[model samples]
Target: MLKTAGDRPYRGRLAPTPTGRLHLGHAATFLRAQERCQAADGTLIFRNEDLDPQRCRPEYAQDALDDLRWLGLRWSEGPDCGGPCGPYNQSERQPYYLEAWAKLRDAGVIYPCTRSRRELRERVAAPHEEDEEAEPLYPPEWRPAPGTGQDAQEPGEVNWRFRVPDGERISFEDELAGKQSFTAGQNFGDFLIWRRDGVPAYELSVVVDDLAMAITEVVRGADLIKSTARQLLIYRVLGAELTPRFAHCPLIRDEQGKRLAKRSDALSLRTLRERGLSPRQVQDMAR
Candidate 1:
């Protein structure tokens, strides 16, 4: 079993996906996590989210570690530096996700999705500022029966969807953004929890990791507020009595007012450092 906060001190984490180098936006959020953990006298953990086999590369992970160190950030435990969590990388933590999948399946909360990516991409909401990439909301009319009907592919070949309650509002108090709420079937409907490729979706992976890590406080970008709401429901279903306090930090936007994406290598820490900028200068720029 994963360790809880119990008599131990608070634990925070720096979760970085190795799809790209750490950009200023990521640096800002990471700094906030480091600051909050330090304030609480907690141990900071670094969890590598190398879930995507294609996008996440080994060099990118190394560069992330290098960039973080260059930016003067330190963590008590990480993939580079081991922790009690053992396998600090998500790619290696597949069994944990599988376990959670079993629980949700037993609870009859997940169903197979038949809709293809090409179909969803054509209708999903436009990209927003520092937020989850919006997937096309599966129309209420198209939802499939739990564990039975498939969308397009063969039975187990299709994706999985978690049934979100229609017309219910998920409300929570954010430490930085204050009170927030999103109505189900309005703001978001049923979302994917597992993919057809046999990989756990970001939603499921994060919640399961957080619980397993005993994350007492989650300090991430404001973009993830909706994610917190979604994960809150997962916690409820999982019988978690104590959910972590959430702190969504302000986002770092570009001059165009759009939130930065990994594609913007010009704004990445590597580029900035290569341009002879000091760590302090980078920190100033991040703010």
Candidate 2:
């Protein structure tokens, strides 16, 4: 059986990206997180994932807090309401991510990639437009020899990818999804931990933050199941004693059967509020 933080007092979190307004889907997922935390009589921390320098906006961040509050959800710790686990915002927690990068670097499990997107697409079997969210598998042939990145002092100036142990199966029992498994290189190849723009990627940042906040369970949309597999590797590489369990709620889709995104403004929590939808009504719609 996998060791988990189940024995610890439940520490759940609602980590919302501030690239856009929270949509109905986001609200539903966060509500699930809050519900699970409350069911366990746990502490709920709100993390603002506003690391995207190009897309994240102060207005969007504020709007996420406002919209979630309007939806009648409350968090004990967050960017607004300070708590012991602050600074709750990802933007303020770069030092923590950088520290993790250094640890991974020192462990010699990560390497620098200087290849551009065009170079990758031309070289590797890139995913098509339908799979835009999916990254092309980093070609194993292109990897520098082991110990190539040992001399680098910092992760800036190039993309850094964690070398996945190919052909190894990564399996975990999700509390909600149940009996999940994925192959390493086939499911995903070496993945980005730090981008060339000096920003820590999602895979690395979330793991570091969860460990730091002592998050006992990760509650998020089911769309992130593959991401969970990737993060599990990070946890092991970082020598995390007890990794959080997962509860993946089903994704909310639009009328077209497409998963809701930040672009789904009509179903955004802010728009729903302006349309006079009550908290109960929105919650019902989410259900």
Candidate 3:
């Protein structure tokens, strides 16, 4: 039986993508995670979301650890300090991801996607009520018949997607954001779970890792509110008796009123520290 959140102690995580230096937006969101976890007297884990080999670098990962530490964030478990969930780095957790893929395959909820990236771009984009960065929905007419992927022993041969029930409304209550809702196939279509390049996609990996780690609450930026709706489907398909509660913190924006990105080096924690800013000063700036 999948572990239920009610039976476990409160557990939260700091999942940082090691694609670039940690920025003020990351600092604000992570600090909120620390505050919430401490309020519940819960354990906090540091997970290195370094699944993209081409983009992720060891130096960047090390920099994240250093920057967060310098910002006064502490965790009970992480890549640096061993814990029950040992391979805290996503790259090292492939076997776990593969297992979840197989279960999805067996359940007939996932299918191989032969569509290439270029072809998808040239086609009509999916109807979306989100930001331009949202992925174009997979054309429902292109789907292979149900059970088309059951013969594949390994998922790396082709990309795999979790088929969402079209037009069905997926909803969840966030501890911070409050009531939220989105319609499947409209907001998002069959989402990628495994890429043809042999990488587990973010939506799948986070769900598997969060459940495996027994996390009770997830704290992240508000931009991912739609992602939470998608993840709720995965939890349901995986037979999770109870899913983690979530807190989507507000994003830190730049002078132009655009949300901060990792490319904002001047506002990065490392850069701020280099400017002789103390941890307290940095925290205040993030606020």
CA lDDT scores, all candidates in order = 0.83, 0.90, 0.89
Error of model 1, residue 42, in angstroms: 0.7
lDDT winner between candidates 1 and 2: 2
Candidate 2 vs 3: which has more lDDT: 2
Residue 126 in candidate 1, Cα distance off native in Å: 5.0
Best by lDDT: 2
Error of 3 at 226 (Å): 0.6
Highest TM-score: give the candidate number. 2
> Which residue pairs in candidate 3 collide?
none
Tens digits of per-residue lDDT, candidate 1, 134-164, equal 6656778777666553232322566888899
Clashes of 3: 0
TM-scores for every candidate against the unseen true structure? 0.91, 0.97, 0.95
What value does the lDDT take at residue 138 in candidate 2?
86
Candidate 3 per-residue lDDT over residues 1-287, each given as its tens digit: 23336646889999999999999999999999999899889999999999999999999999999999999999999999989986999999999999999988999999999997667757875434435456787889989999898988998668899999899898877899999889999988888899988999999999999988889999999999999888888888887888898899998888988888888999999999999999999999877
Q: Looking at model 2, how many pairs of residues clash?
A: 0
* Alpha-carbon shift of residue 169 in model 1 (angstroms): 1.7
User: Sorted on lDDT, highest at the top, how do the candidates line up?
Assistant: 2, 3, 1
**Per-candidate RMSD vs. true structure?**
3.5, 1.3, 2.2
* Model 3 TM-score (2 dp): 0.95
Candidate 1 whole-model C-alpha lDDT, 0 to 1: 0.83
